[model samples]
Target: MTSTYDQLVEIVTKLHNPPADLIRPDVTFAQLDVDSLTLVEISLRIEGDLGIRIEDNELEEDLTLAATTQLIDAKLAQ
Candidate 1:
């Protein structure tokens, strides 16, 4: 089974089409070259695909790839 971390990475890759190496744990949204609108779209995609609700405020500007995976994992655990 795909881990939540890997799944989130895949979602980001699909959304940004970034190079594979750029899609890892330490990466930030800034590195993805995503605009504000894309971030909102990605958030919605994550919520829809993972069946979790992510409020806009929870997705702070400083959020990282690893943190996002953890967020989703926490929501799944709930």
Candidate 2:
């Protein structure tokens, strides 16, 4: 069974549209070179895809793939 984190990563990867190697657990959104609009869109997509509403304030400047997965896992567990 795929773990929630893995599933989250999959969704993020799809939303990010980065190269296969470019998407990694520790890779920050800044490292992805994504603009604020793209980041906001990604958050919205995650909320829609996961059925979890992520507050805008929850998105920190150091957002990373691993951190995103963790956030989703936490929201789902709530």
Candidate 3:
């Protein structure tokens, strides 16, 4: 779980050019410059890393940092 969180942090950090100390669980995709296309790439990467495909419909704006971590955790559990 902690490792997944770390992975998400790394992804978000790369997507956004924010300061290292600015990263946090409350950040949203919009704040990180993650548009639809970037989201797709992130989804693909997550699928590759987790070995599970997430449906497009499953991708929601509500899945910000904390929400995304929870969603990934749930999918891996299933």
Provide the lDDT at 39 for model 2: 72
lDDT by residue for model 3 (1-78), tens: 457778877766665455766567887677665677777777887887778777777765546788788888888899
Query: What lDDT would candidate 2 get against the real structure?
Result: 0.76
The best candidate by TM-score is 1
Per-model TM-score, in order, reads 0.89, 0.79, 0.78
Tens-place lDDT digits, model 1, residues 1-78: 999988888788788788876777888888778777778878898988999988887775468989988998999999
- Candidates sorted by TM-score, descending order? 1, 2, 3
Task: For candidate 2, list the clashing residue pairs, or say none.
Answer: none
57 Cα displacement, candidate 1 (Å): 1.5
Better of 1 and 3 by lDDT: 1
**lDDT winner:** 1
Writing each residue's lDDT as its tens digit, candidate 2 over 4-65 gives 66776676677667677877788888887766777777778878877898787776547887
Output the lDDT of residue 49, model 1: 91
Off by over 4 Å in 2: none
Query: Judged by lDDT against the true structure, how good is candidate 3?
Result: 0.73
lDDT of each: 0.83, 0.76, 0.73
The runs of at least 3 residues in candidate 1 whose Cα sits more than 4 Å from the true structure, single-residue gaps closed, are: none
